[model samples]
Target: MDDRTAEYLVYLDATLTEIAGLARRGRDAYDRDIAVSRACQYNLIRLTADLERLGSDWLAHHPDIPWRLIKGMRNRIAHDYLTIDDDIIWAVVEHHATQLHHALENEIATAKTTLHTDEQTP
Candidate 1:
């Protein structure tokens, strides 16, 4: 991976970590607290936006990442906030975010290996 892609992956990993932390607060807090829900949404948006910055070529290499669905969610959150469903957000936080985080971790590890290999090659 190139430096820019590596940077974006790191950022996405961090944002997913933040979302995971918020998720640990549990469903009750998420349902009752606007702050918790909004924080999750905001972090998700940030995560998706950074995914966009990873560039098409990099995104293409990782076809399993659900690039379209991820970006669609970001658009829904950014452009249609009022109609956003709490249940969907909660589902994403509880399940999808965790899965995505794991995938991101793998990607980060691969990126590090790629960088190391590139360094050694020269």
Candidate 2:
């Protein structure tokens, strides 16, 4: 895989990890924690950029994942930042985190395979 692709996937992976880590803290008090909010925002931005920069084509081939909804989340974060609802973030952490993690793990494994093939070709 090219560096850009790998980097984006890493961004996606890291964001997923951040969300899961946040979920472990439990949700009731988590919504009020400043640190947790920052981590949530940070990953949202990272994943947003990854989707925006990579565009829909890459995601199309990877439709086994929720690429479209993920892109929509990024859109909400990027285009509607001022109206972001903390409750939505909380919901994502609680519900969507596991699915995204599994999807990204598969994507990353495929990228690694591509990287290995490219290395052998030269």
Candidate 3:
């Protein structure tokens, strides 16, 4: 991984943290409160953009991740904000988001170790 990919991974991880914080209020609260929903959506959008910045090459290595669906959700959240359904978004927050966050954390650690090994190689 190059410097930009590493940086973007950090950003994604941080954004995931923020999303997690925003989502802790539970689905009922999120569905009832537009502010909570907006915060989660905003972080999720940032997360998708950061992943996109990592580009197709980086994404290819993690084929198991639902990259396309994530990007599609980002598009829907961005382009169709007015019709954004709280239930679906909350479902993503409660289920998919945690899985993605953990996966990204593991990937970031692996990438850092790989980079460290690469640097040590003469």
lDDT winner:
1
Give residue 91's lDDT in candidate 1 (0 to 100).
88
- Clashes within 3 Å, all models in order: 0, 1, 0
In order of TM-score, best first, we have 1, 3, 2
For model 3, what is the alpha-carbon lDDT of residue 71?
87
Report the lDDT of model 3 for residue 68.
Answer: 85
RMSD of each: 2.8, 3.4, 3.1
For lDDT, candidate 1 versus 2, the one ahead is: 1
Per-residue error for 21 in candidate 2, Å, reads 1.3
- The superposed Cα distance between candidate 2 and the true structure at residue 6, in angstroms, equals 2.8
Stretches of candidate 3 exceeding 4 Å from the true structure: 110-122
Instruction: List where candidate 1 sits over 4 angstroms from the true fold.
Output: 110-122
Q: Model 3 reaches what TM-score against the true structure? A: 0.82
TM-scores, all models, native as reference? 0.85, 0.69, 0.82
Model 3 misses residue 42 by how many Å? 1.0
Per-residue alpha-carbon lDDT of candidate 3 for residues 1-122, written as tens digits (9 for 90 to 100):
67567667777777877877777888877878878888889877888888888889888988988988888889999998888777778878877888888877877776667667777989
| TM-score (C-alpha) between model 2 and the true structure | 0.69
lDDT (Cα, tens digit) per residue for candidate 2, span 1-122: 57678667766676677778878877765767878776776676676666666667777766676656666777787788788788887777777776767867877777667666776995
